[model samples]
Target: MIEMTRVSSPSDIIGIRDLQALNLKQNITAEEAIDQGFLTAAFTIEYLQEMNVASPSIIAKVGDKVVGYALVATKEIRNGHDLIEGLFDAIDKSAYKGKLLKDVNYVVVGQLCVAKEYRGQDLVQKLYGHFKDCLSKEYTYLITDIAQANTRSLKAHKKRGFQIINELVYGEVKWDIVLWDWNLTD
Candidate 1:
């Protein structure tokens, strides 16, 4: 059985490897981690510091072994591509019924991953369930961005009721970024 749990520290190094593994499994480039020799190792130390002090990062484990992780944060965007900026504008317009996002609360899902062996079993939904149970009480909105080419993740999120609200591009990498939202109010 799979289990979801909160991360206690950013320096909780075991999770760093799990996150790296998940990234690799999903075919996401871990260039930043790979190019910087000891940087990946040091990132664990820093991650612990960040999570220990920050309010939104969480990690998943199954029986003492870390298998997946996620991070959620609340913030506003002031600048970005046209589609991105427009999406926020749309969110702001709807969030307030023509008001602003200043009064609304949003939970941004920064990262989410599952073990390869566990992928097709709906573990992703369980992870989101855990996130929703824990975070829904505090925030009314959840948002995440997926690489446009990542059809698997796109389908997964869609199955969970998330809607595609916008699309944008990440500079040099030329990756297509698709924004999705889940309204927890209902």
Candidate 2:
């Protein structure tokens, strides 16, 4: 039985990191990435621990084994990481059209990955749904970027109600900045 829940222990952190490493290793080609969404950036144990400190990541577990994870990042937390900071800078100038992203109550899905066995099960939507359930009350939106080559991820996000708000080049890779707005009052 697969269960979706918040990260609650130290071992869950390690499992998240290990899943990330496995996804990175498999993300060498667009074809592979299309088959299964890939992670572009790597996160250290310390970084994961720190990010989780602010808001615990969502994890999918099956009988005590973690099969997937989605990391969360806030504005203050993004500032502590150079890569995330750069992404936010680009987002501020491009996605928000010169408006500061910090002005919005949003969260970044720093990374998301599901194990091979867990693919084709709608786990991505399940994870994002859990994220929304836990955060939408406090945040107006969720933001993240997918590599231009990652059509699978792009399509999945779109299917999940995320819109492509902007496009930018980072680390020499083209990215599609996506946003899922929870607040519809506007």
Candidate 3:
């Protein structure tokens, strides 16, 4: 049976790293990346462990193997990431209606991915649903940035109820800062 839960053991973190390596932009072919989507950030074991301590990343596991993940991030964790730091600044200047995003209760979805074998099985959808159930009580909104060129991932997120709240270019890639407002749903 598949289980959806937060990272607990060191081996679970290692499983996440194993999945991340196969999906990272640098590790895959350009064609494959454009077709299957990719993870822009490469997280170290130390960082994953740190993130686990702050807010455990949610994962889908079958026995000992991690098949999918939705990385949960606190404000401190988001601010500390070099790639996501720019988003923190952009969101501080952006708002959901009248209030600044930074002015409200929120958390970031640092990165999300499913193992290649698990794709097309609705595991991504299940992971986000589980992620929301895990965090919606404490956070008013779930914010995440996706590479604009990644239509597959973007479509998946939008279908999950995330709306693009802002757009910012970081380096050559333009990112859409998407927000899933739990307040609106509540």
Cα-based lDDT for every prediction: 0.53, 0.84, 0.89
Q: lDDT, candidate 1, residue 66?
A: 66
Q: Ranking under lDDT, best-scoring first?
A: 3, 2, 1
User: Each candidate's TM vs. the true structure?
Assistant: 0.66, 0.90, 0.96
lDDT of 3 by residue, 27-50 (tens): 999998999999998889988888
Q: Whose lDDT is higher: candidate 1's or candidate 2's?
A: 2
TM-score of 2: 0.90
Write down the lDDT that model 3 would get.
0.89
**Model 2 whole-model lDDT (C-alpha atoms):** 0.84
- For residues 40-122, what per-residue lDDT tens digits would candidate 2 score against the true structure? 78888998898999999999999778899888887767777777887777666653544666577778898888998888899
Given candidate 3, what's the lDDT at residue 57? 90
Query: Model 1 — TM-score against the truth?
Result: 0.66
lDDT of 1 by residue, 43-122 (tens): 24444344435454566676766676665444432232333343344455443334455467765664566655555777
* Full-model lDDT, candidate 1: 0.53
Best by lDDT: 3
